[model samples]
Target: MAEKYLIGVDGSEHSRVALAWGLARAAERNADVELLHVADDSFLSESVAFLSEAQQASQQMLDSETAYAKTLGFTGNITGTAVVGHPIAELEAASKRVDLLILGAHSGSRFAGSFFGTRAVKAAATAHCPVAVIPKHEVSPGAGIAVGIDGSEASKVAIAYAAEAASMRGVPLIAVYAWMAPLTPGLEYLWSEELVEAQRSAAEEAIAIGVAGLAERYPDLTIERRIVQSPPVAALVQVGEEVETLVVGSRGRGGISRLLLGSVSHGVLQALPCPVIVTRATA
Candidate 1:
């Protein structure tokens, strides 16, 4: 089978933007595109005709999106698939077979909590491969790739992927490690400037060590390290605005064994200024 890049399309502008981005990215990576449309099974019990009509409409939408992709200058092989079932479950099953899963950040349905719903978060965290969630925005010129490294297995995977993406895009890679300095409740007044500098230096050093091998791997890729003294989500979102893509671990609750969608990665998906990719570590 051809290396497939699957995209979930709902005819929303957000989904269209995601399709466009996915097409270009997949083309650059020499992968085929599969446009998937799913009809909610909730209405399947309404009537047989309703189910049939809905499925037909979904197939039409997938065809429309496939046609639309060609208009966007995507000349690669494209396939459209329509089905009736739970959207998340169907997509989850498809994810195992595809090289990558691309999704629109925003959904028109009120059921989806944010731009990405609860299920989207779960899918990103649990998918077998990396999932790229594209916001309703275009890539800006000269923007670099940003990845968060927090000394976890998932994050290490994310960093490596982000570095490779940056290398492919011919841009720099910004590796951000957000940290907070711990202070004793009553000993705050005794803190010195040297102590603050040491903490900041330690944070930077940690990030540097985390990506030490990337330089050798991608000899021509430029890697910049940033140590932020704020929450991880906020730091990554801020960086996302200035970068082309924000890549992060699907799960990392600031611990070794905690490999699941945490608040930071969750927030970045919803509010990041650029496209965000959530990656799972290789087993």
Candidate 2:
């Protein structure tokens, strides 16, 4: 069976972009797409005098979205569901039975914070499968694929998943490693040429280790290695501008100190122009 793409849409502009992206991807892969709109009763009180009218309006919106999905060439099997409850809960439950979950970073409302607001962040962190966060702006074609690695077990899993995706897409896999310099303030001025060369050599060696490991598993896969001297999030966003997808481990050597999604992952998801895939280390 072909993979199923589940997209969450809430009538927001960002969600509309996500719907388009998911449909396009489904069309390309010849897969089915499911459009879900969760209606939380908590946000809409039953005490309202026009509750019946509100429900009717919501149903009409869902019908229109369903029709829009069909117009986008999702002929295989397109479904639009309206459920009463929390948006994140509904989406998370739906993800358990689907191959992939595509979500919008943020809505157009001023109440919504960054791309990965509280709800989206929680859903992405605990979803059963891979979740791709789509940005709102129009993306150019052929952005390639970028993967972040830190020589940890979790990062190894991320690299494997990224390698397969890049191979399947027939695109170059850019393996990026971001490291920080020593704490010494005047290191460059104090250190001799030999020290600088040694540091450079060490950095190259670490990057080579990661590349060698990947090459052993995927001998035919084409990959490019980049070692940048900066924070992981900064380096990733700088290189991610030209990548179609950015794949990263849900948790890496940095561990959970940064929170459920981690600061770097959250930052990349918020700023990257392309879709960001956060893969589970165990799955």
Candidate 3:
């Protein structure tokens, strides 16, 4: 069966970017594309009079986005859907059947708490499949793929996904591992150079363990290892600025809940430098 990519479209420029990205990727994988637009039923539930108008508006959005998708010159199957419901709930439920879910990143006060903005983060956190959030701006020219590694099972899964993507794109893969020295308030002056070196060595080992099988798995792929002595989010963000796409696990070692996004993942979403892919290990 051909792979399928589900994209959430709201007729905004951001969603258009996501639609284009999804179509290009679908063309590469020979996958089908589905464009979905959901009208908030909460606002219309109280007024049955506006239900028809809302539905009509939703269908118009679907039609417009569908027309836009066609202009992109994608030859694959494209399906457009319009539903009256909660955007997050609809997208989350649909994610189960699709190979991947793609959305556009929207931030700032105008999009605050809306599905185009903060809700996208929530959807990524709870979606069953891997979610790719494409930013509005273009990525750095000639940038390669980058993934964060922290020795967690989730990070391991992310590494595998990123490696496959890099191989498919014929681009190099950069595996980044970041660490920070323990800063005990009272012992700040006792920190020594040897301790810093030990931490650095440990970070190297963690990255090594994180990418143990990449060389054998992806023989033609070039891998770059980055060890930074900073917070994981900061290091990944810096790498993101230089990469075409930044891939990260939905949660890391410190995450205990399956329904929540980890701090690092959440942080990167807030300050996205490029397209970000949030990968979750399948249960």
Model 3 alpha-carbon drift over 4 Å, by segment: 108-114, 252-259
Worst 10 residues of 1 by lDDT: 107-116
Cα-based lDDT at residue 51, candidate 2 = 60
Query: TM-score of the candidate numbered 2?
Result: 0.82
Weakest 10 consecutive residues of candidate 3 by summed lDDT: 107-116
Candidate 2: residue 218 Cα off by (Å):
5.6
lDDT of 1 at 88: 70
Candidate 2, 168: how far from true, in Å? 2.1
Q: What is the lDDT for 35 in model 2? A: 75
The residue-by-residue lDDT of candidate 3 on 44-159, one tens digit each, is: 65576677778888888889889989999999999978887877788879998898999987763242113566777888888888999999998874479999999988888899
Compose the digit string of candidate 2's lDDT tens values, residues 57-102.
6566678778877777666778776655566667768988887788
Model 1, 1-283: lDDT tens digits are: 5678999888778788888889989888888988888877864677778878888888887888788898988778888889877777778788888988998876456431122555566668666778888877676856899999898887888888898889998999999999876666987877688988998888877897889988889999998888899988989999999988899986533333333576778888768578889888765
lDDT of 2: 0.73
Q: TM-scores across all candidates?
A: 0.88, 0.82, 0.93
Please report how far candidate 1 places residue 168 from its true position, in Å.
1.1
Model 3: lDDT of residue 122? 80
